[model samples]
Target chain A: MSHTYRYPRPALTVDIVVFGLDAEDLQVLLIERDGKPFRGQWALPGGFVDVGESPDDAARRELEEETGLSEIFLEQLYTFGNPGRDPREHVVTIAHYALVNLNEHDVKASSDARNAAWFSINDLPKLAFDHSEILKVALDRLRAKVRYQPIGFELLPKKFTLRQLQHLYELILDRELDKRNFRKKVLATEIVKETNQFEKDVAHRAARLYRFDQRKYDRMTKQGFNFEV
Target chain B: MSHTYRYPRPALTVDIVVFGLDAEDLQVLLIERDGKPFRGQWALPGGFVDVGESPDDAARRELEEETGLSEIFLEQLYTFGNPGRDPREHVVTIAHYALVNLNEHDVKASSDARNAAWFSINDLPKLAFDHSEILKVALDRLRAKVRYQPIGFELLPKKFTLRQLQHLYELILDRELDKRNFRKKVLATEIVKETNQFEKDVAHRAARLYRFDQRKYDRMTKQGFNFEV
Candidate 1:
């Protein structure tokens, strides 16, 4: 009746891929490493998982400690466990991804984090360890998830123009969408509500703003009203 | 700057949730335990990760050894690492799920698996450890994954009738869809191709069979074609 182990265990860690959307492009949060193997290299914000905490808890804690970020939409991405992935013995990392509006969190490195900064996905530097692979996986997941899930809201302000929403979709999907068809399909879904407001502080005529109705989306999801781009 | 760990590491394992679709229902594979901590209780098919093996490799190896199923569409589900999840010690298992057509493999109690059987997802027995939680996550992932990804093909025969395809969708989605709407949407995607064949062993008039065109689907995916049900 013994399930005891004699083999050595791999050290577990948690990493976070914090994605942010700006006016022009999609960006990811990276931190300059303070210590060795890949010292001074940019990497995703993360650290080792403590013995007492769950991976979800560890992900949140590591993200906050490394980047001064809290209360964002975090999701488990994948667990990377190649034996040679880390130079210092056997290590396995459980990766989590997050989406945050650029205006919300002012990114700064603290605690064990050296210099946290947002890098455009297309213009990222050579990352530490297997971080580039992790970021790639996170981006793919985000692209796939944003279509069917209401995750695009996580990257936008509370009220936004239809053009902005369409832009977000285009950036993640990495293609140009037919504007007329996109507007027609999105409006038909009824998930986005036209607000009684317009954009302010613009030189040109302001566009109308809209909000994603979370309550309606949840109810419709139960009834199988799929949201697609 | 030593980045080495002094803390004891928790043992790592890989567990699999093998989902299969039969003629009448959707099912999950469970294996009876031959060794302790939960002897004779049904649980997921899995084992510890060897030092030289990746989690993906370990998952496939464990699934084959435990269930005698191979070469199915296995993907990493999640990592289960709640403290006290395993009573014997701290064992965090990386879970993987696979979609299989029941006709391909016969279930038996083989290897370390004492007895392997398929249980209807709606009527599963009390499972060992946190296997119920793992199964719940897998089902949710499958439900979400089925809508956007062409994963449903893994659970179906290569050639099937439209009725069977619709039925599978209904079962996974947990609701019935309009027949005409379903046909129109699926056909419009052009992912399914009509085979020059019909059901051979039916009492009534044989219905035409169709196959999921994976190559076409991949190419269309690159061109921003989405698969929805």
Candidate 2:
């Protein structure tokens, strides 16, 4: 313990809560611990932050190392630094949250993780360490943020029907929205553009498909547009 | 270094952006550094996190020790952890932002601070060690968050006229809002209950004052009430 600084330093780590939307509900990616300190228990995919490495980079690297997922957009959720959170020593973990399309990426267990699986947010097992609290905070952020920002689109396919879009919002918000009012408000925002396409396989009616207009959203955002749902 | 951990841990710190409002514009509290490594330069009031202390506790303690302000409601804004942020070492700071009523508290320069003072957000001197970036992030958070949440009330007196409340919003948001529309929306929220008292020392017509009903807001929030201004 003979470093340059006089005070004792706390160890730092990074953890990420990855959210994916499926047909019925919202799911999160968890990895089963392969080593000590809660072996055989599930936790968020993360590890120690290397020296001279940014916390953001550490989060991405650890997620890719343990879950085989990369190129995903991650938002810094919050930093958990309770002294008693870690068992070994004073460790603080910077928590981040990400949204991904469920059908796009497949997770593989690697690194210090024994197994990687997706569990519905409603039906999660007892996680290791203070991970359960981290996941709850991430879920609250996702629920609150999806209303003002269009991040829920990250959990959906590129081309989708209005019903599918509403379903994404409903799943994240954990409530059923009025169809007519939801459609009216979403259309009024003018960020979802109507594509010259329709749903392919449907029994009753084939609804028209729409795509999120990023350029329009960006331009409107610059013009101080208020996006609320 | 002979620590139990295999990897070297980066030093952790906490920096807080303290914001208060006046009639003219928004202001932030800064302290002049009294030690080496950017000594004599103005910076946000903060210091290294002590061992075995929570980051939130460190934030409150540092704010009180350096600036003599305590019991302020501090919100975790964001964590800035780039390697080059601190020239002395690889330091990661968990940043927080707080809003205070300008007339309530007085600040004294103590601990490592040579002098403490409030400056307008639009006009700030050259700050030390990525403190400018931290202040900017805090200001952006305050501007974006005050609209959706009623955190702006923290910067106002317990009993305030509607005009004073509107002026507070206009200063923080940096925009002019229609008087009729602003009052209509604020009244519609019903969180700001009208009081029987009226303005005392005004040259113009005395407007009725109001106070924020925290109990009602809490009850309404549990029922899924959304506050927007």
Candidate 3:
């Protein structure tokens, strides 16, 4: 008996939503495409996945290649595969979200990409492909994850003030969190450790700095303690 | 200038991990294929998705066709797109898990499927394709989900005893939960309403039955009540 098998192949790409906090505003990194399909159009930093790398690795590599940033907290958000999403061809993109501290990287925006820049998430321009939808999904996941996990620290600097932490929560949750209530809840979780330091240069009084105590959090978590803020 | 357009497309398929919980053990539904690629071998219910239907809807339709069961709680777990996952083609499958009450459906083992049957999760045979890995991922998700959410109820009857509920939790968590603590946690959440019904025709002391109060749970959930069992 002879059998014929038809190979089914799909073009796979990875799109990353790199989020950063900049001066009380939530921002996302985007790139202007330098190639075809959407030349010169603004889009998420992404590209086709290579042969052997996993989708997560592809997302990280694309982000690094375009922005020179890595070692950040990244997660797989979703896979966007609507056949009509890409007008030029059938591209399936695995969307990922990366949280980075803006202060750590100066963002050499004109490297591999036509132009890389940070845009306030609220003030995003019309993006190429289905990036708008992908951004929305990433934001939703970020909000949900922030509520249940300690991932919000990823968007903050290594050492931050309680006010900054509260602001980050307010930005993600899109609401005004009472300073007293926010600090009370966050400190009660015991995930933050007070540092013997303060902000270097600021107009107002420099509040005491704190760092995410991952070791203590991990130990407590293994002992069946829940983290909520 | 002449323009060449590259159409981007991803090969899409739907895979379902149908889980059933008999009184004693957790089982997954598998089918014997009558076609090539894995002809005559047992596999998970799946097929290439058709145009005009969402991958989620395609998964549901495939489950119904291959298992003759519908109206079950189905959730999109993850998309599996490892390059070598499918030997016959470069296929990316959107894997889903469906929880059905075993008592509700008859064992129509050969309805639309060549040969379909439920196998205990522990003693599953060498499955066709990458189904074994898919099954493992689904089970991991189920185990994690059962801890913080009330989805385990989907595998139970509408009216269930406290003991049955406890057994389901133990089976999913693979650990024994103290009965008193379990009852206190579940009852304190107020998601289960006592039905004033008792088990009939039992050899031992009959236990009172209860039903999940989804409406109350929904309202309480909106009010930020966390349900953990």
Candidate 4:
């Protein structure tokens, strides 16, 4: 406690809300603390920010370390800086959120000496610290942002059918959308390319697959495209 | 130099990107530094975060202390925590941005012994530190947000003409919007209420004035209304 600054300094940490689209709803990644400070309670997959690393870097590293998930895109959500957010001391956590395809990564509870698991966002367990508040904010941003941004696609596989895409939107937006209108409006944006492939290993008829057209979306965005659903 | 901790703590600061609409273009509030570390240079109005205050409170206090403005909407934009961002030391800043109506506040350059000024977003002078990058991010967010959010009204007066609303959109969006289409789309949202009033002190035929109905907007938003341009 011998810091000589004009005022006391707060310990900084990073927390991430990783959302994945399950078959029926959205889910988030959580880690069961192996030790004290909310021990055995599930919390966001994050840790302290090392001395020289940026908060972003710390978030990415922590995501990989605790969840065994890497190479996913994450965006800064918000910073939670209440003086007593962390019971251990005066710690501030920069919260980040990311969308991921669950099929791509297999999550294990015991990785890197940490226990990780996936919990349905709507029915989450008792979270540690102020993590529940962080998750709520992340969900609100995901709901609002997917309307204009193409981030929802991150939760789906590269090749997906119109049904899967519609289901993804329905789960996040929490509204039943008309299938015809959803198809018409999405196609009008010209942001999706109809692939010749079809869904594999389905009990019913396999619907045609479509891929989000990154190049077309980028060009249209530059030309002032207003993406609304 | 006397801090005693398991890890080195980075100094924390708060920086604000204060935006305003000044009739012709979007503008930002900047302070001309009066002391060293960029003395006499233009920078965002901000300072170090006191230990006990949250970042949001720090931003509000700094905005008022340095610019003589308060009680406005300020949202946390992003946190910049890369090493070497501040030359003086290892400092991380939580960046915030706010929308203000220029008519309501009188900006002073020498308020509280600080030199504060508003510069047009496009014609801003070279700024001190990494403030230029911060300003660019804020402008992009503003342009993107105005299309879906009713925040553009923050830049306009309580009662404004449809022509004034259209002009504000064009200036922020940097596009030539068709008047007929703009009015039809905006009216369909039902967020604006037409007042039995007209613009005064204008040369041409006065246009009907309108006010954004906050209560209506809040209700519509609760029902999942999508506001898109």
Candidate 5:
């Protein structure tokens, strides 16, 4: 079934759009490319898809190698392939986005990258390649996906106050949701288990913390329960 | 900012999943490969991305050349780039799905295809490469998308009967929907404009005809309206 027929193949690469939520705003992780065609320029953390690795694996590997972050929720966003996207060659990049807890790990620039840092989504710098467009698409997907799926938990810490959860939604959606309604809907789902804990070193009253219960979510989903806010 | 540098790149290709709905079952168009690398076997309609065209353009062009289908609703589904997917080469296929009205155009196998035919989703033949997995993902996307989007209309005629519309939904979701409730919801949306027409030469009752009003749908969507069945 295989013979000496030869045809040129297009180049493939994997790009990661990591979203981190700080206290103030949503941030995206970017790496300074140390090599051309976009050397010394900031772009998505990515590299060539290595042999024997799936696109998802390549994306996760690149994210970890470039940002020192792993074990987060990631999903394929879209593939970008404009013929002239890369100046040096014909490169098609499969873009994926991941949600990680910002407070869990301190980011350090990888040895292969010039620098790695998180920038507020609202004020992203001029990026190398067509990464600005890719980030926009990823943000749109995150906003839409958060509304229907319970993926926002991935961006938050293991234990979080209700105020933080509400703020996360407000930042991602770019709208202020009704506090009472949001709380009512969220609590009704019963996916968040209240922990006997409270925030420390806060000026205001310390709020109780809750952890997302994945098992409860699965059970409710199997029973035809829906979650939306 | 532009200079030549030696960096690795992954191979890219395009894969097309053509979906058609018959009277009783949903079908997908498959092509029999006549050349090496799974010769004399069925596969998705696809090929390598040309150096001069965008991935989206390559996908649409490939669909046209292989299946003789053009100007239909097409979308970028996902990119599959498992390094071990293609035996002869390191290929990453950007999978696309096109919804074609089977009644409008007859698919004539052309280009590199030896034969093209519609296979019912329930009963599929052995496919070349990893096309079987690609087709399953596309079908899952179609089922999820059809429930929230008006994409099902793309597979129907310009003007079709209400019964035809209901049948399309039932076949896609693989579930029986109450006809009365289905009619209530669909008519409520006002996306379908009733024509003073009815089906002809039927053994049973002559169903009323309706046409999808794209302009009205667009206007409604622009006014922050949601379309759900």
Candidate 6:
């Protein structure tokens, strides 16, 4: 089937930047393109928006189809519509960013994706089509948002040590924090609750685990409680 | 001339929510449509993206051509691309929000806009298409963003009294802030510099005026200064 327009329209696409936390650094997901026009180049896992599907739905569908990642919450980041960004035509991409637990989303490249892998944000290769710029914007947003909101919990395990939580912030913010001050502020915020659990099977002493108290966070937010780190 | 695609593509457009402040309340600019499908209906001032034009450029051009607004910084808010948003065909709109000094920009309707006027956000007519939803989202963003960012300065005059500044926050946030706390926080941020000027032609004792120091704001932001009101 073919469709024609009196005036040419820019082809719409959706790109996603997925961030996950590993032991040492923050990571982003990239896929090797298998088609012409930047084929074999590493790019964000995304595709053209299908007809009858909303951009949000298209983002979710493309992420799952290409990278085997689903059920993750995706937030609309920005729209990149530079005329020559896509060599094939005037393709405008609505970019989105997501946070996921690395352990839960075991990626398997499928469909149009030649290969998919996670690269530490600190070290990344040249990306195809303005994706590097898009990823940079997403990182800036993540850094600013993580400080004021408790979104860092999305990148950690359900039960984690305070040290682990602090490490997540340090990685995202790219700065060292005073250990005592970090713990004091986090506990004072009361967004994380102590669990009657601790780590198992480690050479070093195990630390008690805590869970993010989402209900308390929501309640406190309603009452205008500010969360900062 | 026309172009054809192998698969149907959603027509792309841009919609902007321009916010300004009046003496009494926060206001939004709306244009009465002069075209079919929603003739005489109030809607956000926007139009279709022409070929070879970026969405950002399209937004600025449309805002200028339809509402006589130019040189305003427009931030991309979100993409609304649900099917049936436009009765004509599948259309995807990249939404943007901007802040303008009400006293500086004088809006005059042209092109497809039959009339242009400012309406208090609290009192708006039935907007065309999904604009009401779009406006609601913009309002939510503005309310949340103004709390942490100093964008509110765009609404007031170049030099304003502390009372006017407080009123801007109170109106956007729809709440009464403690006068002492608000003043202290504003002063401590150091983003607002006290001017050697005071209010002129007032019915009572004139209050001192201040100006938003963008240079100081940028420098302090680089040094990790967070502004909260």
The C-alpha TM-scores of every prediction are: 0.84, 0.90, 0.79, 0.88, 0.91, 0.92
RMSD, every candidate, angstroms: 4.5, 2.9, 5.2, 3.2, 3.9, 2.5
Cα lDDT of model 5 by residue, B27-64, tens digit: 99998888889999999988878766788999888888
DockQ-based class of model 3: incorrect
- lDDT (Cα) of model 6: 0.87
lDDT of 4 by residue, A1-229 (tens): 3345556788888999999888977899888887788899999988888767889999999898888788887988999998778777777888999888988867763368876777887789999999999999999998877766677888888888888999999999888999998899889888899989987898999899999899976775455444456
Task: Please list the residue runs of candidate 4 whose C-alpha ends up more than 4 Å from where it truly belongs after superposition.
Answer: A1-6, A180-201, A208-214, A217-229, B1-3, B178-214, B217-229
**Candidate 3 interface CA RMSD, Å:** 9.9
For all candidates, state DockQ relative to the true structure: 0.33, 0.48, 0.21, 0.43, 0.39, 0.75
TM-score of 6: 0.92
Q: What TM-score does chain B alone reach in each candidate, compared with the true chain B? A: 0.92, 0.91, 0.91, 0.92, 0.92, 0.93
What range of 10 consecutive residues in model 1 chain B has the weakest lDDT sum?
A: B1-10
Give the candidate order by descending TM-score.
6, 5, 2, 4, 1, 3
Tell me the lDDT of model 4 at B70: 89
Docking class of 6: medium
TM-score of 2: 0.90
In candidate 4, residue B66 scores what lDDT? 89
Per TM-score, the best of the predicted structures is 6
Quantify how close model 6 is to the true structure by its C-alpha RMSD in Å: 2.5
Better of 2 and 3 by DockQ: 2
Tens-place lDDT digits, model 3, residues A1-229: 3222244344578999999998869999999888777888899998887655567778888888888888888888877777688876556677889999999876784357368999998899999998999999899888877765778888888899999988888898898888887888888888899999998888988899999888966665444454455
Better of 1 and 6 by lDDT: 6
